[model samples]
Target: MMRKTLTSVWPLFFGLGIIGVCIGAQGSLLGIRAELEGFDIRVTGLLMSAYYVGFLLGSLRAPKILQRVGHIRAFAALTALASITILVHSLIIDPWTWGLMRLLTGFAVSAIYVVAESWLNQAANNRSRGQLLSIYMVTMLAGLSSGQFLLKLADPASFELFTLISVLISLAAIPILITATPMPSFEAARPVSIKALYHLAPTGLIGSFLINTCYAMVLGMGAVYASKLGMQVDEISLFMAVLVVGGMLLQWPLGKLSDRMDRRSVICAAAFAALLFALVSGQTGFAADNRHLLLALLFGGCCFPLLALYLALTNDELTSDQAVGASSTLLLVGGIGATLGPFMISLTMERWGAPGFFWCLAAMSALMAGHAFYRRLIDPLPAAGEPSSFQMQAPSPVGSGLMKSPPSEN
Candidate 1:
């Protein structure tokens, strides 16, 4: 059964993996290039933030586009747009122009995820869904990690890297466009009220918001921090790669552990551990050597799977019908957090220097830890059997499968 399911979805997995490579490399490449170009931290932060702005808008609008065009056509159109946008970055050097490209890139990427994930979900059944989701997550992480090492391929200061990114984005479209597989039907999810979502799962809602805020801080600013520390591009690549590797290696073990105990406890433990790692990486003078790399590994291990826990907790409180709405609401909150994270963290970095990046991360992780424990005290866990079965969640807000509404009953 597993083999058969895998066989069926191989194309989707392959396409998504390629997309991950493009995304991972493009982010680091742009950050490094922006620094080399002498763009200010504020402009860099805004450049990063613009992507999330476009992403949030794309998530809201992509479903309508999908409904009109169908998955394959939508995927092709978005991929082509993304490819063109990456090349545009190479032709232009201004922060404003790069920011505009990032915005379009984010929109295209978000819609691509919508097409990919919704197709995967349609291909899955109850028994195989969990396994497929795990495979999808691993594939994404592996692709992201591998892409980081591609930084060694060309200098960020040159146009070659941007061209490579465009090539990858273009390649991602080929598998889906050529596949004989039928397109999955997409139903647009109605927006849920934030007030109702808060009432349903306050802990999950707040944690999702704060966690993504931290994520955006790290992903958007980490490259800039490394560059400022005088690390070469290759070292920066390894740093980013190790962070993703840590997340990939640890997700399953941590996920399984959460299933056996109170998930909130696991969340608190992960948050606290992440906070400690961030502090060590940021504050200790000795950490400037290889010690910081190890710390980054530990940090990613603890930090990456947080959204899964948040989604699991949220799902536990929601009916299937409400699941779609709740996921959309939670993603919106997360998007808002991501949109603001880089700008706020950039201000800190400006005042406090590179260490400010990790300080900001530590502070956010501490907030998440503290809130998780407080919620545990006030709201008890559901009975062991009562919680929804755990499933691996994609890292991005846009790809949560619950974004698709269920078919209507006659």
Candidate 2:
């Protein structure tokens, strides 16, 4: 029984891993390529933001599209579109044109995720749900981390590096295409209203947006920031890797804390810590290469978990149906914040140079802290054992044939 079940779902995991690789390549490539072109920090930020705009739009529309196309067909088509789009980016150097392509890529990737997650949900049984999702999450983080290393393989100056990205994305389709198992139908869920989400867990939803805003800015322009600070290209990649690695390492411990106490407190503490790091790092002007490791550890490990905390916190308040709606709402809001982050951060960098990026980061973190603090006062704790609607499954579970899908509260 175990063997049969494992065989049935391996393709979904493989497919998701491939998709992760594709997404990671884009992020890695963007950091390197933007800097190579001598684009202003502000322009780089704007270009990066464009992708989020597409992602936001696509995520909202993807469920409906999947409902129409069916999972397998939708996955195949979008994967193809995503592959082709990355390849096109290699050929274009114009920031504006690249932004448009990125938007399209974002839309396509969103649909891809929708398809992938839906498939995983369908395949999962109660027993395997947790295992499958752990694999999926690991795959995502590893693929993303590995993608950054690819930057080392190719010269940033040549467009050939992007071709590699294109190739990787194109190849990602093969595992799914060859799988023999029947694909699952898309699960229908109720729609969630944005307004209702705000009312339910205002801090979590808002924090999700702010955290992504900071994350996107760092991801988009951090390489340039490193270069401006006199670090070499390889060092820049390492800087980012450290950040990601630190974040991955801290996910477990910090996650446990959030589960135990008021998540609002966790948000406030993390935000303050991140703000402090950003301030010190920005002021030192990247003088501490040795300390870069520390910055990445602090930001990526402690600061980055803010996103997860935001999700978990939001989930804490929701009913099953409300959880689905709230998660969807958080995605939309986070996407918007991500879209805005790079542009604003880059603009700040343009005016102040190196300090601009960190300053922007600190400012956002401070805002999150403020938001959390205010909400802490406005909202009282729920009585013990109060059932939460937003406690949606952290990820699509593994092993299980079908974990209950969150009831759509729409």
Which number leads on lDDT?
1
**Best candidate (score: TM-score):** 1
Clash statistics: count for each candidate = 0, 23
lDDT of each: 0.83, 0.71
Segments in model 1 whose C-alpha atoms lie over 4 Å from true places: 285-289, 381-385, 402-410
Position 121, candidate 2: lDDT: 67
Model 1 C-alpha lDDT per residue in residues 1-410, reported as the tens digit of each score: 88877787788888889888888888889889999999999999999999888888888889899778777778888999999999999998988899999999889988888877787777777888777877888888888788888789988999998998898888877877887766677787776799998988888899989988877777787788889888899999988888878877787787778777788899999999999999998875224568989999999989888888888888877888888888889889999999999898999999999899888889999999999999888877553336776666555647564456234111
Total backbone clashes of candidate 1, pairs 3 or more residues apart or in separate chains: 0
